[model samples]
Target: MKFHPYNLSRERLLDFYKNLLWPRLIEEKMLLLLRQGKISKWFSGIGQEAISVGATMALQQDEWIMPLHRNLGVFTCRNMPLNKLFKQWQGDLDGYTKGRERSFHFGSKEHHICGMISHLGPQLSVADGVALAYKLRKEQKVSLAFTGEGGTSEGEFHEALNVAAVWDLPVIFLVENNGYGLSTPVSEQYRCQQLSDRGKGYGMEAVTIDGNNVLEVYHIIKGIREYCIREQKPYLVECMTFRMRGHEEASGTRYVPKELMEEWAKKDPITNYEEWLVKEGILGNEEITTTRNELKQKIEKELAPNSARLGETYAPVAEEPTSAQSSLDEVYCKEATSTSETAHHGTPSLKVEGTSVRFIDAISSGLRQSLRKHPNLILMGQDIAEYGGVFKITEGFVTEFGKERVRNTPICESAIIGTALGLSLEGFKSMVEMQFADFVTMGFNQIVNNLAKIYYRWGQNADVVIRMPTGAGVGAGPFHSQSNEAWFVHTSGLKVVYPSTPYDAKGLLNAAFNDPNPILYFEHKALYRSITGPVPEEYYTVEIGKANQVQTGVDISIITYGSGVHWAIAYAAEHLDISLDILDLRTLLPIDYEAIRYSVKKTGKVLVLHEDSLTGGIGGEVVAWIAEHCFEWLDAPVMRCASLDTPIPFNTELEQTFLAKARLNDYVQKLIDY
Candidate 1:
């Protein structure tokens, strides 16, 4: 049977034609510019425009859509201004990402769109987060994400699908099977007869459609969207289509068989749709010609390279950029200046009596208080809800907040982290607890590439806190006892906070939630039960980037944080002759430089201490900074006391030997004598 426009109104049908035609014309213009050496690259959506146009038109304005690299129709269908999009492609400062990115790597919050990163499957999980918010808020909105057939191989694809299916989230996962993933064919990409068939394994309904038929694509998507909102369940839709051009302008199409191209060319979406419209007397050939001409003219006018500052020539490469050009300044939110926000920082405005508590209990108290303050706060992790977490930090949380807020996610780290980003996009706060700090490797891409880079790339705040239960003392081998704080500290955009005492744990936990940036809250597992201190019963937040000066002395300065703080204190108590000034660096990323400078200047000799291995630990960064800035104040060379460069052994005796505390006395005394 021949396809139709789903019986759309005459005006609506004409608008749909424009949506399909505009992207085709724009793609053509982009190719010309690429040949003329204006733009560096182009991902052609030449033949597969209907998938983007049809799928986008089926969704409402308030609903969110995650688009892929070739889905230019998503931007145009949402009514994003052509000039701004063209400026973005030309690397203009007026573009959405301020020329920080190129091509379609940018997303527009105003348009209710989230664009994909180079790693295609992470956005699928991010879309799940958006749908999760809709489910929680009862918004009756569904989120849709687009991916290529090749992207289905990513672990995030399976993770996102299973999480959505298990939770019955209102989301649609659309895989546009454009025949080829780069040069790899569908046969090699996956063994399934079709991409949608894999959805059944995820316990979700699945379907395949004639993607070249715009009306069929629209009809299926619209119905599926309604079904998802009503039932609050996920669905998988695969559109079988073909790309007419190479993957990009530079990649030639020599690998594609000639016969396949000829067959798909005859079934071209635009040409076939135009014939159907004319055959049914929906419009005459003259009208179709007139519309095509108008769209072409509009593309030319909007995409004209009028600015000498943009696209005329690329900027000259600089060996070193000035401070003004550094992205570090703009990536993090400036200190909140409003009276209400400022009041939440430092000490609590209302003084409350203190109670002695275990470090784990203190964390629970802070999280419980924050949940009460922010009713929409969400807590997610494996076995965190009904199971009360492995450490029982959230033992009674599920009873206080329902299952909706206290979510127990699958063993899908990438999806959960990406979902946290999605929650942040909709102005909700979320915290993801890694079962152990070592498992962060499973979600490393989503954390560093997506969460850490979001604010720097597109001016979006990822208001999510990742709780890491770290450090070693128990006989839990190398897997569970890694001190992995340095990995995130080296990453530019994430805020790293490791608190030693119960007071700082509760206070830093509160502050990390209140702050807008993505924060990694590292809780040393060894200190969870072993450490105890007085924590305020009432709500309070310790400043994130400030260090706590535990004690003051003049002989030698010991800078440390987390488990090292406890070790330093024990050593100081034993040695009264050598006066020790101890500084606990609560935050690692935005290291407390001022506090370090003051303590180093006072004592004249310094030792950087941390639980991480000595080779590339945060101690190196501290030592390097002290050498650069406080060289004149030093009485001795700056030294670092850390665990040996080896995995934490499981044996109790070996573990004790592996810890920095075993060698702490020698390192501190050597620095004092120097």
Candidate 2:
């Protein structure tokens, strides 16, 4: 019963029917429940079941699949339990995401399925990463991602296709062109003849197939999957289909013309397939009825209450929270490394031992150490391979680790970051370097929505360290020079680390690599060549969420990080009469409040300093905390010394005037004299 290329027996044909029927029945039941006010909404895949069924059935169980919202057949074909899926759609605690998300928004690691987000295109690039993993490991596995016709318009779609093609990774970009994208007709969506043609633009082989013909889709994709693995190249398959129902049950299809609906209805996949089965002598009418009846019964059994009727109101089992504080507690992972319990009251805690190295070299040394320690560690960014990196941080990495470990990505920031998350999903650690910190805005959605929220949404850890070369000073202008640490510090699931010295830089980088959560490691570009300090040749780690006392004094506290630390040290050297307690905040998100409090209490005067602009900076957060907690100990009003509220100027003189360091003497004098 072999089907030529692969073992698609007669029994497998029957199983495909079952897979198609299951979603059709489930959609009917969900719509009924919606009418009864039991479920909130439903994204029905009434007629598009064949595409998912055929595509999923073609892939191996271990091969990863990134499914869209309409791919219920993908889950069923992968053998996800019907009961748990029902609970997930019902938003019950027993769901895969623990009711954090509803519908097809939850990824199941066990099923090898990565779920979709509201923003549709990121998952496509993530699939490229999964495929890249297979390529890197030389595994004969292909990664598949589902997207609609409208998704092709997304920049990520273009980036994913080009990346996969360039890398010669085994991946299938499946586009389900369902005539319309939520009321916008195909005519309005794109001017191209076929969505598959866009794939050719990326230099990949593309094809269009009849989505309604389940047998055709299954056969084509099965062959394509084999070709991808054999050639280690990407393929784009565009399935032409029509949405038999509205985008969601709530959004009615009033915009769809009656003539078009009537035309598509005559080509119903189930009815047509049943006729083909009967006419070809594969099965009788009775067998078709029997198969449909069994599918209906199975759905009924799964959805029914303990003793209630089949279609009766089935209330989900309620599960209460373990504790009221559990939600807040899980936001950050509990760390093994401990920070300072009590600050060095009036003494500098920094040891300053070992050979002196520049800040950039320390970073390079730490990265080299990490790469040597972990074989799965990947460094991804623009110009990071043979060209090293923008800062030569990975100069000899390609020769040492090869191109598989040191990947040079396209200028698609969003895609590279999403790829990092995908690599993490498949048990690989990644370090993504932004050529300049400003370019991070391109990948902001992936960082905030995907990486930062993945662990919180579905308990999937994103072991990634995004290296940001930031801060103003070399007159790099508005875009290149920016102390943008505050942007990620405001985000919840991310750890922000900013180090000032070579020793701290090397140690903190290693610490960030060791952590399981997503971390933002900010390296000030200005300090790269200028600052030199003692750095150990051996691998070591500095505890995150800790502050270091660089210089100890009793009169005033200069609380800062990055360039501010150097400014404080220089000011202290010149102004010998005034005593300054220079405290460098190594991490921003978990802002070493204990160290700040101890220093403020000891000095009785506080001056928050940073290279970022004054109005909405981390300095404001520090000043607010001081005002709230250490108001009674304050000798004068808590003041902030920060860059003027404007973009970093390109002119050297103007830049110097705009920087907070120019005003540090006046601010420190005022605090010390008070």
Candidate 3:
């Protein structure tokens, strides 16, 4: 049977042809640039351009698109200026990422397109959040997220589908099954006959279509999009195509079978569509030549030296705003004049004096107060809505704020963070709870790559807080108990906060809510009920970057935070002979260097301690900083006492031995004696 184009008006057919031509020309030009060593890398969608073009054309102008690296057709179909797109490849200052990134790692807020990272699957979850926002706002807009068949194998792929299906969000998951993931063939990637079939497990309608058939792809996507908007339910469409070329220019077709490549080459999407148009008498050969020539000229014009500012290093012409300027620009940026500041100026202050509360209660109170103050605040986590989270810290929140504000999510940590990022982009403050800090590994890519870098890259404040219930001691073994603050502290563009006391937890959470950046707020699980302190009822904010000197002395300085704070204080009190100065570094990322310098200078000895694994913990960074800055003042080498470099054991005695508090005590005493 001969192939025929799907039924469409002549004008629509011609438009699809033009859309296909632009990306085809762009891909050819990009390959030429790659060969000439003008660009660093190129991931060409030579045969699969139809998928991006078709899916993008199906969406409305206001709808969002979270495109992958190969979706240049989507950018073109959206009328992204060819000059800006070329400038991105040339790494020019006028590019979307200001030359900081290359290829498809850039997007425009004006266009409602999200810039994607190398980790492709996380964007699927992010698109879920965008769709969630549309549903919440009662907008008929739907989000389209594109990924490869290989991306479907990622954990985030399943997580995103589950969340979107459960929430009935308006999102279309487009899987461009190009037969191969890099050099690995699809046969080895998955056992399923069709990648879209996995969506059925998540209770969503799924379908597979010929990706090379541009008109069919467009028709199917349009219908799916309409259905999603009408029903506010997600649908997955797998477009089966082939990657004619290698993954990149450098990787030739060495891994692909010559016969398979030859077979797929004949069905090249652009050529096949062009042939159909010509055969059907919709477009003539002369018109096809004219269109190709015009597209080539346009691509060349964009690549012109003057347009790209070539030969000179491109630098940002506009001065980037400082942190203070950014803070002042935020709508939620209001300085707390005093600890007793209320939600409104004229309203009576709700401050309570000497009201003792457990650590968990303090956190819950802070969340409750923040939600009451900000109508746009959203709380999400697994089992948070009814079960009130695993620790019951968010108990009664679903009842008080209603389920719309307090959400229970599926067991999808990456999606939770990614969706929170989506909510934050829409000017909603989202506080996502990681049931346990150990599970943060599941969402690490989204947190570090997407959540952490969003603010710095595009100047968009990701006003999101990731509440990590962390630490050991309660016999929650390896996967459940871990002090993972060090991981986030190592990542730049993230604020790490770990509070030991009830007062600090309540106050710092308020401050985090006000801050216009992503904050990783860690709460020690052991301290949830084991500790209690006076917390004010009114809205109060503890300065994010400041350290509190819990105890004052001049002999030896012990620096700690979270669970370690209690141990250090107890040890200091037990030995009256040692004059100990304990400093609780509530914020790890923005370490109070001045306070550390002052304490080390006065005491002339320093010991940094934490409950995280000893080798790569935050303590190592502290010790390095002290040695670099306060080496002259130090009377002894900076010491550190942390949990042994091993996973937390299930046995109570083994766990106690693993996290030996005596080791910290011995280190502190030795520092004092030295």
The C-alpha TM-scores of every prediction are: 0.96, 0.95, 0.91
Off by over 4 Å in 1: 304-326, 335-353
Ranking by TM-score: 1, 2, 3
Best by lDDT: 1
How far out, in Å, is residue 242 in model 2?
1.1
- Residue-level lDDT of model 1, residues 315-434, one tens digit each, is 422224446647668878664412222122111123325888999999999899889988768999999999999999999888989899999999999899999999988988999999
* Candidate lDDT (C-alpha), each: 0.87, 0.86, 0.83
> Which pairs of residues collide in model 3?
none
Against the correct fold, how does model 3 do in TM-score? Answer: 0.91
CA-only RMSD, every prediction: 2.8, 3.0, 4.6
Identify the candidate with maximal TM-score.
1
Ranking by lDDT: 1, 2, 3
Residue pairs clashing, model 2: none
lDDT of 2 by residue, 1-674 (tens): 11222456667767777777888988887788788867777898888888999999889999999999999999999999787887787777778877778799879888999999889999998898899888888899999999999998898898889888888989999999999999898899899899898877888999999888788889999989999999999999999888988999888889999999998887777777767667667768899889889888998787764223224454554478555477667776564334222223234675667899899999999999988877889999999999989899999999999988998988889988888888887888899999999999999999988888887777788888999999888989999998888899889899999999898898889888878789999999999999998887888888788888887788899999999999999988998988888999988978889889889988899899998999889999999999999999999999999999998899999999999989988987787667
